[model samples]
Target chain A: SQQGEEDPQALSIQEGENATMNCSYKTSINNLQWYRQNSGRGLVHLILIRSNEREKHSGRLRVTLDTSKKSSSLLITASRAADTASYFCATAPSGGYNKLIFGAGTRLAVHP
Target chain B: DAGVTQSPTHLIKTRGQQVTLRCSPKSGHDTVSWYQQALGQGPQFIFQYYEEEERQRGNFPDRFSGHQFPNYSSELNVNALLLGDSALYLCASSGGTSGRAYNEQFFGPGTRLTVL
Candidate 1:
């Protein structure tokens, strides 16, 4: 399976704190993506990092990918209460049709 | 520029029954994919359709089938439903051309299925 396995299935932190989640996958990938889901609803895409890239960032999110280790991490700096949601890591295979295999996800709780 | 859309939002069914869920791809997107997400788990790919044909499928059983129309609208049909089938069904859309690499997927709100 090409599924990404997320670490720290759950995490709790105070507002303004940095929250980080890690994911490891079994096979090579073309890219790794992070998504946020609130209330088990539709997932909002956060970012995508290609295998050739080691790190990337969006407004408040920073992602690092280590293809040699087949692992990735997502860092949300100064998270707010509104940031509370389940975070998932999905991988697109290196040599296959674009079907993503997702991890169980990390449940994040940001307390005010 | 509408994103992916799915319906009905929710459904209830019993064992041995069949149900069909529908989806409309994002504007300009011609490929559609379906996923099943069990409680507390991430979404699992069921299948994908492009150009009104099944392009790829996951490990899902034949009981789960789908169709994609020329307009890029899609449907997921499940037969002989079981209790384990209860979950959130998600639809995603990407790619405007059949030869393009659709790496970025836009997801719909999803349809929640409850099996009795």
Candidate 2:
């Protein structure tokens, strides 16, 4: 199983505060991706970090990948009430047909 | 320009019954994948289709099968459905096998399946 496990299954924070989520997976991977899912809706792609990349940033989101430790982290600076949603980390294992294995996800609640 | 699309939006079925869910991949995408997301859990890979054939599959039972048309549209069929089969069926699309090293998948709204 190439599934990733996210730490802190849930998180609650106030508006304007920062939120960080971690994920760990087994087996080597080609890349890791982050996604956000709203209540009763499908997931939206957030970012992708390749195995060789250490860190990348987009807008208010910063993603760090530590291939040596088989882990990754997502940092969202200045979160808003609309940022409240479930965050998932998915891994595309190496040598596979590009199928992604997702983690259980972290449910984030941002209080306005 | 269109993202992946799935239908019908919602479905209800009983045990031992059969159901089929449909999906249309994003424009210019030649690969389609299906996932089953149970409550409180992440989406589990069901299978992936490319060139109108099953290129890869997850550890699902034979009761769960699929077919991809030449148009890049796909269908997931589950026979003898069980209560545990209830979940959100998501359809994702990407380029083809020769795509970039990191082929980003675009997901659809998903079809909610409820088994009684």
Candidate 3:
């Protein structure tokens, strides 16, 4: 079964605006990673935050993990039309680190 | 250096037929994993391979099987396919001491499989 669940099935925003997506999981995780997919193609690895990490940043991407709440959030600052895509949250379960479980995902549209 | 690679960018097959998808891991990687993504949904883990063994599997049935070659490349074989099996198949590879998924994974372009 899918371990992670995301909110805001879809989001639309203008360029230069910040977009945030949230994800919640049911089980404990060793790590949580985010990925972006364009159309229906391959997924592009984004930032990953360990269970112990509260926040991390890579360029305009910022991710936060709250283990206490079993949730994580991804924030894209100053969005661009090129940033339009589907974003997913994946978790490496504490019980089985070899299997990555993913959430449904959020479709983001950045309009110029 | 080249990243992970997969063959036959797209494929089409009929229900009840079988299909094989291949993947070559990135340089220095020895573990391969597979996932199935339905339209408008996140990718679901199918299985993971290491040392030419089926190390771990997901909720998929026995019909979904895979093998890892000595070279670290892998193949995912689906027998008696169903229409629901039609989806994008993704291959991911990582280099870890125990072939664990906790490490960052490099993904291939994925093969689009359509079942009629």
Candidate that scores best on DockQ:
3
Candidate 1: true interface contacts recovered: 0.56
When 1 and 3 are scored with DockQ, the better candidate is 3
lDDT of 1 by residue, B1-116 (tens): 67889999999999999999999998988889899999999999999998889989999999999999988899999999999999999998878765348368889999999999
lDDT, candidate 3, at B92: 95
TM-score of chain B of 2: 0.95
Q: What TM-score, to 2 decimal places, does chain A of model 1 have? A: 0.97
In candidate 3, the residue pairs with backbone N, CA or C atoms under 3 Å apart (3 or more residues apart, or in different chains) clash, namely none
Model 3 clashing-pair count: 0
Q: What TM-score goes with each of the models?
A: 0.97, 0.97, 0.97
Residue-level lDDT tens digits of model 1 in A66-96: 9989999999999999999999999988776
Report residue A3 deviation for candidate 1 (angstroms).
1.4
lDDT of 2 by residue, B1-116 (tens): 77899999999999999999999999988999999999889999999988888988999999999999989999999999999999999999988556434588889999999999
Candidate 2 Cα RMSD after full superposition onto the native fold (Å): 1.2
Local accuracy of candidate 2 as per-residue lDDT tens digits, A1-112: 4379998899999999999999999989999999999995898999989999999999999999999999999999999999999999999999987899999999999999
Q: Which residue pairs show collisions in model 2?
A: none
DockQ of each: 0.68, 0.70, 0.74
Better of 1 and 2 by lDDT: 2
Docking class of 2: medium
> For residues A10-83, what per-residue lDDT tens digits would candidate 3 score against the true structure?
99999999999999999888999999999998999998788889999999999999999999999999999999
Number of the top-ranking candidate, with lDDT as the measure: 2
